[model samples]
Target: MSPALDVRRPALAHAPLLADPVAAALQAWVHADGVGVAAIDPDLADTAAFVEAYGVASDASANCVVVGGRRDGVERIAACVVLATTRADVNGIVRRALDVRKASFLPMDRAVELTGMEYGGITPIGLPADWLLLVDEAVTLAGRVIVGSGLRRSKIEVPGADLARLPRATVVPGLGRPVG
Candidate 1:
């Protein structure tokens, strides 16, 4: 755990997402699932900034990127988790896994609206039920990791293996490639 970071229960945060029925349900689900939540300054919610400010190792921080594509004129979305040291293979691995021809990051507005989570605070725990959740194999091997808590003001820390066990989550090898 990052030093000086305050870990709290989701219900105590009073985050906007917790007020929404869907997000609230997801919050409860994560708690019951045994994930720990840590509150931080909203301004430092972005991965790089948070790591720099809080001394969290980048390799132990997971980033969740929302991707969108279409098949048969219907939109398909997925939430992909990868270590901050790597980039999700959105154009290749993720595209192939999702069975979509062209895949790109979901537009911010749509992602935020659909997940009911802040842009920099989306996690695999409470995503849309129908959307795919892909966890990079490396993430699951990293032991404990820091991830978003559905609110920019907080984050979740859990064993990587636990994230891989989220409902609808699939562990994909090479889902993320090392950053140059």
Candidate 2:
């Protein structure tokens, strides 16, 4: 395990991917459905590089993006975008979509704390039930996409269509489309 993955979160479980409740639940959900998951020998923080380095199909890489939440003592919404060739123009789309007064990238600690997913490995699976899931339309084009297993060392390669089954996700246009 890389030293950077030592999230050392308080509520984190001592076990691997099952350490966090959300993570554990996520693993259980995928496993129960018999999701065909695979892991890479090397750790990948960058989704694009992970796809290239691991020979993971580009169309099938789900990048777990953590957009800022409505922090009025509650996380109203968090955007989990798929990993593709571009980035999410949060200011233009996410903010307007979530309808929050303001939207920005969540602090690392806050993101880790709220999502229960390790830094450099945040995935949409096993996140808080209340957090709104916004899936980019382009991601549905892939047959399989590698996503975080709520752990840094592990990732789950799941079918693009199946992602919605894990969580009631909301499909949004221009999630990765250029804002300008």
Candidate 3:
């Protein structure tokens, strides 16, 4: 299938462009099959800069954020995926879904350490099996979306339906609200 972003190349054809875990997942994770990857300047990994530099539509890109909170003195963590044009309702939907009193974005160092990925390049693929994955409904309906490749030097383009099928993923309505 054609990608939402015109610049993507078949991921399997350029495994070196992907991070280790990302490459492994693309090979083994059934949900990531057929996804595309594209090399990009590491300086433009962030959504805004990546979209602008690559001339990709903002809505075609998605962000994966790490969040966590404590309940009954037990910490719980999850990954939230939402379109670049919107922001995850972490304080509301995520906190409730995690069943924690409060939820906050994970510290960069901690997130990077726990996920074994770069701070700005975390993706839902290859995440710890225990971490819940919350994908906004809008993303699943987008047909295709651009996401991190677990590295800053490349991006993955996958069918939105594929993301919804990832292990531990739950499609959440209103998970993301339009950014002001």
Candidate 4:
């Protein structure tokens, strides 16, 4: 872990949300894969606030968005991860990638309910087994990145390559575009 990340936080296994299978899966993966975790104030969990408060570089932080669409009356969902300086191309790239006519950000309520994680705290580490995980290729190139820890109270610092190794994760070029 880099010096920028606080090492005082409890391991992911000890996090309060571990009782949830999604979170527990993340904890298990982090331990098994050797990722790092940092504690943060739940109140400042939003990306902008967390970055500003902690002096973390925005480029080193990643955001995960859940997108949903339907095809042939069957719903399709995916978790997209992009650097904070970029925006996931849900309507264009993602819709095409998912083979759905239209792809949009999942409703907050539905996302929170399905992922078993709080809004503003969703991470790709422990998504539902059946859901697709899309990671921007640039994210995989980032040496070390900060992402949600399945809870707003902490964050995980992981090598981008490690994130690419996630089961069901696909590294897609142009998955995200630079934000204006």
- lDDT of each structure? 0.82, 0.63, 0.87, 0.82
Tens digits of per-residue lDDT for model 3, 1-180: 222344357887788877777777778877655688887778889998888877777788999999999999999999999999999999899999999989999999999888878877899988988999999999999888999988888888998878998889999999999998
lDDT computed for candidate 3: 0.87
**What would the TM-scores of all predictions be?**
0.88, 0.76, 0.93, 0.89
Model 3, position 168, has a per-residue lDDT of 94
Task: Look at candidate 4 and tell me the lDDT of residue 38.
Answer: 74
- lDDT of model 4, residue 118: 81
Select the stronger candidate by TM-score from 1 and 2.
1
Worst 10 residues of 4 by lDDT: 1-10
Candidate with the greatest lDDT versus the true structure: 3
Task: Give the clashing residue pairs of candidate 2, or none.
Answer: 60-145, 62-83, 63-82, 63-83
lDDT of 1 by residue, 1-180 (tens): 554764445433544423253355555565434555666888999999999888989999999999989899998888999999999999998898778899999889988999877889888877888999999999999998888878788787778988887888999999989999
Q: In model 1, where is the ten-residue run with the lowest total lDDT?
A: 10-19
Worst 10 residues of 2 by lDDT: 2-11
TM-score top scorer: 3
Stretches > 4 Å off in candidate 1: 1-3, 8-33
Can you give the lDDT of residue 10 in candidate 4?
47
Select the stronger candidate by TM-score from 1 and 3. Answer: 3
Model 1 TM-score (2 dp): 0.88
Candidate 3 runs further than 4 Å off: 1-7
- Name the regions of candidate 4 deviating beyond 4 angstroms: 1-5, 8-10, 17-19, 27-33
